[model samples]
Structures are given as C-alpha cells and as structure tokens.
Target: MSAHTQIMATVAPSARFDPDLGVIMPPSNGMPRSVFGRPVAPLAKWRRRYAACLVVLDFVAAVAASRTVVALFQDADAGFWDQRVLGDTVSAFVLVANIGVPLLWLVILAGAGAYDRRALGRGTEELNRVVRANIAMAAAVSFLALGFKKDVSRATVAAIIVGLLVYTVFVRIVARVALRRIRRVNQRASQKVLLVGRLADALAVHEVVTRNAGAGLRPVAIHLPQYPRSGERVNAPVPVYVGWDLVPLVQQLRADTIAVCGPASLESYELRKLAWQLEGTGIDLVVVPQVTDVTGPRIHVRPIEGLPLLNVEEPTISGLSLLAKSLIDRIAALFGLIVLSPVLVGIALAIKFTDPGPVMFRQSRIGHQGKAFKVWKFRTMYTDAEQRLEALRAHNESDGLLFKMRNDPRVTPIGRHLRALSLDELPQLINVLMGQMSLVGPRPLPTEDDDYRGDVRRRLLVRPGITGLWQISGRSDLTWEDAVRLDLHYVDNWSLVYDLGILWHTVRVVLDRRGAY
Candidate 1:
C-alpha cells in the first residue's frame, strides 16, 4: 500500500475499503471503536448533571415565587379563577396553580433552550434565554386567565411573574458563577480539547482558548496536517502531533473535543474524512471561523445552493433599541438624582467643609460623534490638583493615555473613600440627565487624550457613559489598548440586555473596589 493509503488505514482501522469512492467507508457499527479500552464518558456525564441541576434550580425558583406570592401578596382563601364558573374550592385552585406553574416553567425553559448544553456554563446567552422564558411564562399565564374570563387578580399575577423573573435570573447567575469557579479550579470538570490545523493557526487558537479558562476547554494537544517542510521548531504549549493516526491519538489522549483552528488548512475531503473517523465517538467537532470579534447575534449562517455562507449584520447604532436606551437613561438618571439626593447633599457638604472648593468638578470630554461635553464628578481632589498634575507626571503609574497614581498627594482624605467606593462618580447622573452621557456605554475620554483614529473611533458611535465595560472590567488597571478594545466590543455588541448586565455587575465591582484607584 502507498504511504498515504497506509496512514488512512491507520486512522480508521475499523473502516472497510470502498472501491467506488477510492477510499474507506466508516465502520458499520454505530459507535466507533476506541483504540483505548474505555470511552470518554465524563464529558457528557458532567454536562448532563449540570443541566439537571439547572432544571432543579428553575423548578425551585418557580415554586418559591408562586407560593410566596400566594402567601404574602395573595390571600390563601382566594381562588385564582372565578369560583362561580369553575366551581372549584379556593384552596384546591390555589394548590393547582402552585403545583402546575413550576412544571410548566420547566417545560417552557426547556423549549426556550435554557438547558442546552452549549449555553450551560458560560456567557450571557444562558441568562438571556432564561429571561425570555420568564417573559413567555408570564404572557402564557395572562393569556390563560383572560381567555377563560377568570377573575384572576392582576396585582397577584404581576407579583408572581415579577417575583419568578427575579428569582430565576438570580439563581441562574449564581449557578453560572459557581460552575465557572469550579471549572477554573478543577481541570477534570473541563473538556479536553485537541486543536488541529497549521502550526501558526493552532498556536493562535490556543492563545484564545487559554484566555477563557471559564469556557471549560482545556487544550491538551495539537495536530498538524503535515510535518513542516522547513524543519521549524514546534513551540506550542501543548504536545504536538503530525500526519494521520488522528483517531488513535484522540483515543490515547481521551480528548472529547476536536477544535479545527482553520478549516482552510485542510482539504475538504480530508475534513470530511476526519469527521467520518469521529462519528458516534462523542467527540465534539468545532470549527474556528476566520471572522473575529463579531458576536453570535450578528452572524447568521445561510446555505445558498450547496455552500454555507456567513452573513454578518450591521451593528445597531440607531433604531428602536437606541431610542429606548435614550429614554431609559434619562428617566433612570432623573430617578437616581431624586433618590440619592440625600447622599448627594451629604457629599457636597463634606466636600465643601473639608476640601473648601467647588462641590462638583467638570472637565471637557469627547462624547458621541466626537462632540465635546463637560463630564461631571464630585471633586475628589484638592483645589490645586490640576496644578500638581505637571509635577506628578514623573510618577505616573498608568501605562496609557490616562494618568493614574496609586496614592496621589492631590486626593483629600474624604476623596480617598469616595474614589474607592466610586461615590465620586455619582454626580455624573446630571450628565446622563442632560443627555451628555448614558448609564452604560464607552467611557468618554478627555479631549486632549483624543488619539482616537482607525477602529478606535468607533467608541464615539454612541453616547459616552458614567460607567461602562471599562469601568466594571478593570477600571484604571486596564491598559489603554485593553480599555479601547472593550469599548469597541461594547459598541459592536450594544444591546439593552448588555447594558443592564453591565449595570448589574457595576454594583458588585464597586463594592469589591477591584482595579479602583
């Protein structure tokens, strides 16, 4: 046999030679026989367990929300439906809803793809699905009540739906956080990934994989289509393999995932053959697309004739969403200014008493479409802070356009606490109220620091924010490039859901005071 033929046979020993196609057919048995004695079951088992755990959690949340609402907000003797029509006892009707709602919740969650293994452990997609499911459940309840002409209390229904929504989202977030923590600490919980492609492409994909430890993909080895003819050294972090014998190697390593780094490196037939070899082995095949940075919602795969084409939708810069964002920002800002007025007064008084300067500080910042506006903040520095900037330039700790110092002499004692807790940023609500800023968007940069060119200028596509991806991500600890990248990512993937998520995390990040100056 030729060397290529011998390699092919080695790769798929169970396959029979096919005379028609001039190749081998996959094994007749459904499951491919592993070169090693045992199959990799942990990969599938753990995922099933995780999904089951989510099911249990969702069910619990549903029961608690419904029961608690019926207990507190609703009277126990009150029947959900009109007794004159259904002729059921009040207690019996209450019991039925308390029992039935949770079961229906699980069904809807499953239908909404909340328990899909792909979204179980990470990303906001899981939470998004959960939220969507909750909304659907609420609508379903409303429709049932109205269609039956049942005398359901609108207040009670609203309480139950709102309570359930809050509880489910909370538990899911907690579960995801716990799962990620476990995966980061325990390698066995993660999937063993075998990267395949050209050397450069494999290494690049490895970098991306390693960066997201929470993703549960542990790269254990790399496979090249052919040995390098230039005799270059293999410097990959994982063990490197070459040529065929892929099935044997996969079995030996017990890798449950085969990530194709660049499909362009492999011939179409070779890719198909690899897929054939992995059939029914429970090894996941992942293809890394050449397109980078774009999120899943924007990318749609359309099959034309026989070829699958990727269609990337344009980023939403203006639409009903942006209009909603604008309205929410202003209303929330106005409400915040009113609710926090007491705290705001106290801060102003403290600043006036201690610092003996203006209570508010405003500086020119570049906002949406490069428009210059004054960004407001509580004065957290001495009156002569600007004058001191020139001298402190030599002691600058930041590795970017912004100046940062761990312990600057300009900060007053009260300012230190304000800065740490991010209370100094509260007055920016005025900016949001004035339409100069948003609750969540790219952080506005000082006009003098506006070196924004190329793709970096995309940050100006939307209104600047009082707090944003950069503020919650690392604050001043992130380098200029990292900050810019995050802002651009937020711009490209802007959604109301994304904004709400950032705002939610901002509370925790503020309390933790991570990366705070």
Candidate 2:
C-alpha cells in the first residue's frame, strides 16, 4: 500500500485500540503553542473579573440613582427634611433598601439570562428584559411600602424607577461596547475550540463560529465520526480529524474547549460513553441541543440516581397566566383602537375609493379549542379573492395545508401596501379585545381540510395570535416544516417575555417587508 493508504488502514481499525503511553510523541513543528503568544490564565481571569465588576457597577449605579432622586425631592419640601424622614435612621434604611432592591433585581436579571454574552449588543431584547425585571421589582416594593405604611412619596418612587432604567441602560450599552472592543483587540487570544460532530453539523458549526469570530470561539479542528481518513479539507480555515484520532489530536492541539454537536445516528449508550471518556481532559465540553429557539428556561435537568434526565415542560397558558394575558390583550386592544381610529378611518376611505368593496374582510378561522371565529382584517384582496384562490392553487409555495403566493394577481393596490406593512392585520386587535385571539400565540389558521392533523392541531390549545413566530420568521417564505417547528417551539417555551420579544421583532420584520405575500 502507498504511505497515505497504509496510514489510513492503521487508523481505521474496527475495534478501539489502546495507546501506549511510553511511545515517543511526535515533535512540534515550531507552530506557536500559545494563542496570540499569551497564556490562557490571565485572559480567563480578566473575563471573570470584568463580569463581576459589571454586576458591582450596576448595583452601585442603581443605588446612586435612587439616592439622587431622593435628595432631589428632599430639597423641594421642608416637611420632607423632617428628622424622621431625612435623619440618619431614615438615611440608613433608604441606603439598605436601595442596595438590597438592586441586588434582588440583578438576581432576577440573571435568572432571565440578561447577562449572557451572546445577547450583548444584539438589540433591545436584553434592555426590555432589564426594564421588565426592574418593573417587577418596583411593583413588589410599592406593595411592601403600602403594607408597611412607609411615607415614601409617589413622585420619589417614580423618579427612582425612571432613574434606574436610564442608568442601567446606559451602563449596559457602554459595557457591551467596551467588551466588544476588548474582544477585537484580543481576537487571537480567544478559546481554541475542537468541534466534534457529523460532517454536516461540523460544517454548520464552523460557519457559525467563522461568522462571529469576536464571540471568542476559534474552531481549530473538526472531529468526524467513522471516517478514519481525514476527509477532503474544505475551504474553511479549520483542520479535519477523523475517528478515534480526536483523543490524541485534542491533546496535540491543546484545545481548551470541545463542542459536541448532535450525534449522527449513534446509540445513546455510545454517545454517553464518548462523553465520559472526554471527562477530566482539562477541556470544557458543551453539548449542543437538537431543539432550536427553545429558551433555556423551558429545559430542566434532573439527576435520577446516576442518570441525568432532561425534563421539558409543556408551555402553560391557563389559570393566572391566561387571566394576565387576557387583561393585557384587552387593555392594549382598547387603547390601540382609540389611538389608531383616525388611521383606520383613513385606510377604510382609501380602500373604498380605490375599490367598490367593503372596507373589512371577515373570514372564519380556527381559534382556541378548534372553535370557529370570524377574524377581521382590512380588505387587502379583491372581493372575489377567495373564489380566485383555486385558480392559483398550482402556484402555492407554502408546505402542508397553507396556500401562499408571493405575487398574487388578486391583491388590491392599497391591500398590497397594507399587507407589506402588516397594517391590514390591525383589525385583529378587535379580535383580541373580543376574546377570540391573544396578543401572542400560534397564528390562526383557516379551518380548511388541509391545515392541520394529529398533534399539529394542538396549536388551537390557546387563542391564535395576529403576529406570531411565523410572522416574524418569514411569513409565507417559511416552509411547512419550518412554520410548524417555530409554532411548536413557541408552545414549548411560551412566556410573557417571549410574547414581548415576538411583538418587538414583528415591528422590525414589518418594516423590512420580509416574507409578506
């Protein structure tokens, strides 16, 4: 055999081979051992210290902002400067309360995962979460103040809240920008990652790591299963190693991290055994879950004796949660109807002037519990659009039971603009107020024969949403499987936070005019 073929044969043994530790190892080829020519100790220590410092800074900022508010109002009233109100006793109490409240707020923020590096500099999601957490803290404090009959004024409380929000947002933005700059400066000093997975998953992971180099993951080697020979090296900058070679290769590369992407058709026992073998190797092992977009809060790990059992709870949408959602939806819909009445009237007039049809189109759609409800939307299609659907059925691009066309001929001129901007769906706010739908949930489907089946029909368990996961993703551009996956993910991880996130993304997607049919 040729030298390359002989090397492959020796590495491709069916049974695992035990390595001799006394065997002389190959010499290093003068490649630099340390990334960026610096030791890992100092960089890791700096990152941890930086994170702790941010927490401390946030706590201090919160207290300082609260104190500023209190001091500002103290000078405004002579009575506010009374001995009991502004004396040392009250000052100490206020100090303790301010510090304790922000610390508690930070705990809640941590629980909500606001401090994750991945979410930093992403968008307003993290900021909104911080605001919501502070709001919750404020509400709790307000109740406590009322119960204790504390003489705290409403204006003082409001000022503290406003100040905390402003200060926290400013700190978060500045911290994130500074961290991004630091990561850029230390780009090559990041963690060396060894990716272990099937070939396809490894490729996908490489793409993600390459796209976000500042995230500090540098994939130096890919460990592919079964294939004993190093496969044709793709254009990606990483080296590929195969089979049991990973054990020695990881040692050779001195990688600090190993990310195990989903296994390819491997038995669970084998996968677990592989994981066990990698333990105590001075490398952090991260397992990437198969489920996507299901937030961390939805997943629970329980240790049963020796086995780790994963528990995924079904999304809750009943009792007090249902009541809270209903109340918010009704209040929001009422205010939206009042505020947008003029715009609604103008759109109606424009539609009437442009087309000789009714301003609104009410269609029977499947609602919660498979009940039929008439969902209202501004007429965005010709009056005979429903009749014309059959003729365009051959051009349908959506998967499963949904019918969608990118450029249908039946849409009115005004309707096209309305659909593009999602203005046509504003009438569904009435549906929300009328209790036929929710502000966030799976999108309502027409009760046509092809729309649902079996477990997929569980989407009707809660009120349908006007703008849901499907809307923010790609609307009509999403395949049937993609649409179902997103809806199911929502069902598994539903929360008020998720609802607000979808609502926020909806605005961006609408403005971008993505996936509108």
What is candidate 2's TM-score against the reference? 0.67
List ranges where model 2 is wrong by over 4 Å: 1-74, 78-158, 166-195, 200-222, 228-258, 263-285, 290-295, 449-451
Measured on C-alpha atoms, candidate 2 has an lDDT of 0.70
Steric collisions counted per model = 0, 0
Who wins the TM-score comparison?
1
lDDT per residue for candidate 2 within 428-474, as digits (tens), equals: 99999999998888888776634578768768777899889888777
Candidate lDDT values, in order: 0.79, 0.70
- Ten residues in a row with the worst lDDT in model 1? 17-26
- Please give the RMSD of candidate 2 to the true structure: 8.5
- Candidate 1, residue 309: the lDDT equals 92
Error of 1 at 289 (Å): 2.1
